[model samples]
Target: MTLIEIMLVLGLIAMLSIGSLQGWREHQQRARLEQQAQMLRIYLSGLQAQSYQYNLSHLLWTIVGKSGCVGSGIKPADCASAGDSLFKPTAPDITVGVYSEKTMGFYGLRNMAQAGHITLTNAAGTIRVILSARGRIRLCSEGKSIAGMAVC
Candidate 1:
């Protein structure tokens, strides 16, 4: 093959590889966000189960940012927030938001309380994991909705 032809083929291959790498990176980021959201949901459900087993009324799941250890410690003390007596230990960089009803009571399995949501966000996108008080978990994208689904 001519030198020019060889160079052209190499350039095309490089372009294709770059494109593939970009696509793969995007997919990996999306998967990470989904996994983070799912992890938060699991922690929230576990907290609820603990509340039920212990019959504690003041237990709450709080979302701690990178700066604060507050509710994410062994005991829900030394935190800045007032109602955040419970927190899930998460990575230092991730921002997970937890939502629950504002009341003092143990959340039993049969309570059927208002739905709670956990939001996981990154540079790529955001994923919201919805947890019903009745222990139903659903996944939804932020600011987008489908038929018979909730948007966060």
Candidate 2:
């Protein structure tokens, strides 16, 4: 083939390769988000189960934003705004993970901050939930799943 024709074919191939790489990167990021969201779901279910089993009235009350939580009156509900006493071991910990530039939100609400003791956070492809205000866990993305989740 002519040198010009060979050069043209090589350039087209290079363009295709670049496009494929970009697409793959995006897919990987979405996959990470999905994993995070799933983690969050599992955490929430567990916390709900725990409180329900123990019949912890105060902790359960705090979940849906009612009074009677361990330190709601004495302290603000915002996780970052709380004091040491609010974070005491006796208190049910409802904390989401932290995020900054590495995080993005669904509907621009990536950080759910604190609600009772269920915390939600997202860093772009990563999201987590910290329950009983104890350990940190990941949140699953709201999307269709090949794992037989019929809804997002």
Specify the highest-lDDT model's number.
1
> Which prediction has the highest TM-score against the true structure?
1
TM per prediction:
0.66, 0.42
Span of ten consecutive residues with least summed lDDT in model 2: 61-70
RMSD of 1: 5.2
* Predicted candidate 2 versus true structure: per-residue lDDT over 23-119, tens digit per residue: 8866655554445345545534554444445543222212122112222233356544554423221122222333232221111122122332233
lDDT for each candidate structure: 0.56, 0.38
Candidate 1: residue 40 lDDT (0-100): 60
- The global Cα lDDT (0 to 1) of model 1 is 0.56
lDDT of 1 by residue, 1-152 (tens): 99999999999999999999998877676666666666665665665566567654324444445433323223444455434444433444446554545521235545443455656666546666676656576788776442223566
Backbone clash pairs for candidate 1 read none
